[model samples]
Target: MTSLVRSIWGEPEERKLLFKIDFFVLSFVCLQYFSNYLDRANLTNAYVSGMKEALGMTGHDFNNVNSMFTVGYTIAQIPQNLLLQVIPARILFPVNTLIWGCLTMVTAAATHVRHLYVIRFFQGMAEASTFVGAHYIMGSWYKDSELGTRGAIFSSSAQIATIFSGVLQGFIQVPLAVFIVSWLQRPSTKNLDQLHGIAGFRWLFIICGLITVPIAIYGFIFFPDTPETTTAKYFTEEVGLAFILFCVP
Candidate 1:
């Protein structure tokens, strides 16, 4: 009975302790995604905010902008994936994200139909890299058993981004804007509905752009090239388990 109890209570050799990198990496991925979805859905928010009325856009223009983004997205897809293979993802992903962030902010600057087309085109190219690149990174590093969890996490990120945007615009955007207006001596936002002669939709783009800074910095500073290259704080066993988890899927 004593021997059996000892065996049952013993630690498994394969078990690992928790680590900070685990937390950092997971949070960075999710944060990047939250900003990404917020930026992407800003157009939809703009539509709801009477941006179409302000800009005199018909639903046709909105549809055209979305379609144009899709076309650019399709054309850029394969090359970007290939590029992710050759270029260091650490450098490439952040740069691409920054471009998309700026383009998203510039969406507010659209004065004519052509402005939307141009911004959306570049924004599509910038946006295409991260999703495919992140998936590829997970695939390269994570094992079969770990793949499902990674994929699930990735999917949940997308869902969360969309949900954040929807909930903010649906329930919180106006109230939040009003609060900002009243709270500050020099508000970070002048008026979400109108800023610098641009419609409020553009301001949302700018907000999304700014919001990504911490995450982009995190990726640049912490995302290692490989498991062996990591400088992030983790126990030896934790690092080993991370690779094991990566490969499991």
Candidate 2:
């Protein structure tokens, strides 16, 4: 069993390097992607939870808003990839994430469906690089044999976050309901909508933004650029040079 595992994972030194890469690269990207998925999916929650009625959204308003986001995503995807060639992943990924988080926070202030359209468009543009950029960074650090496992982990983080977003919404709603009851109550009003005139949709965006912005900060501090360009404290010059030599055909 030990020999079989070693055969599958390479020698001890390779395994150590793999472990470091997983810790530095996969872990940070997983966290960033988790926040990205949460922010992306929370729009649906916002729509159903209170945004539609608050903004007087009707007809195909939801579809149109989604379409606006898709347009931004499509427009930015190629450009974002091109930009990544010139910018370091550590700088590019975190900066985009921070911008997206700010956009998500701005989403909480949306007063109309048009506001949503604008915010979602830019939000989508900000997030356009996350998935593709992470994949590109993963490829830079991982060998072909290691990519399958790391890729699976990176991809699944988003799915797990989708489920967590619902739970996060639930948690946000609890505090929001309390706040509404305590501060928004009127003599003639029995519910938040009657007193505050809006559902708690705004809070959802704010909380998601808060979650995202901190992770972006963390990413800037810890995210490994690429093996070739990384400044990770553990992966010294000798290790990086050795790895480069090992990869040459």
Candidate 3:
């Protein structure tokens, strides 16, 4: 078994190093991407579920809100990528994640369309670091022969999240819908206030935002940046040196 594993994955020492990198680096980035997509997709779910009527939004308002997010994402992409050269990924990635998480939570409180426009725009700016930045970090760690698979895995997280957002919304909506219908048939207005009048869409944003913050905290503590500059204890100097040497032509 050991010989077969070595034949496919290289010697034991290199295999151990690769495992560490995948655990600390790839796992965090994939989870971050997953959370990012969850936040992004929740808006559409919210809009359809009840946000449109609650906020009194009309045609083109939704489109414009999306445009605001796109504008912020596009404007920040170049600058954010450039910053990766100077700022450490550990600092940059986590900070960006934290910012977006807060913005997502703030979306739950939006009383007007204008509030969504502003919050989504800034959310896009914060999320601009994720997709491309994950690729950049993966390239820093994985060899050319190993990168393609890792990149594919990273990209797939977004698709999984897109599917998951719909499923999660469905799970939240079904039971609540039943309860609301039953409550409406009741004679008493008593305990109706206990529901706090929070819309289903609002809960979607709140849940997604809550899911994002811990990912940022994980990145801050475990993301290894580049092998050259990593501070992760598991990625010792010897392993870093060997990894760098292996990458040299």
The digit string of per-residue lDDT tens for model 2 on 126-198 reads 8898889899999988878889988999999999989988876665566444443466455655433423544
Candidate 1 TM-score over all chains jointly = 0.77
**All candidates: TM-score:** 0.77, 0.84, 0.87
List model 3 lDDT by residue over 1-249, tens digit each: 334433454477777888998899999999999999998899898888888988999999999999999999999999999999999999999999999988998998899999999998998899998999899899888889999999999999999999988876775576443453454434433322213576778867877888899999999988888877887787675454565456444
Residue 17 deviation, candidate 3, in Å? Answer: 0.8
How far in Å is the alpha carbon of 57 misplaced in model 3? 0.7
Choose the strongest candidate by TM-score. Answer: 3
Clashing pairs in 3: none
lDDT of each: 0.65, 0.80, 0.83
* TM-score: the better of candidates 1 and 2: 2
Candidate 1: which stretches are off by over 4 Å?
1-21, 170-173, 178-191, 195-198, 228-249
Q: Which ten residues in a row have the lowest lDDT in candidate 3?
A: 185-194
RMSD of 1: 5.9
lDDT-based ranking? 3, 2, 1
Clashes of each: 15, 0, 0
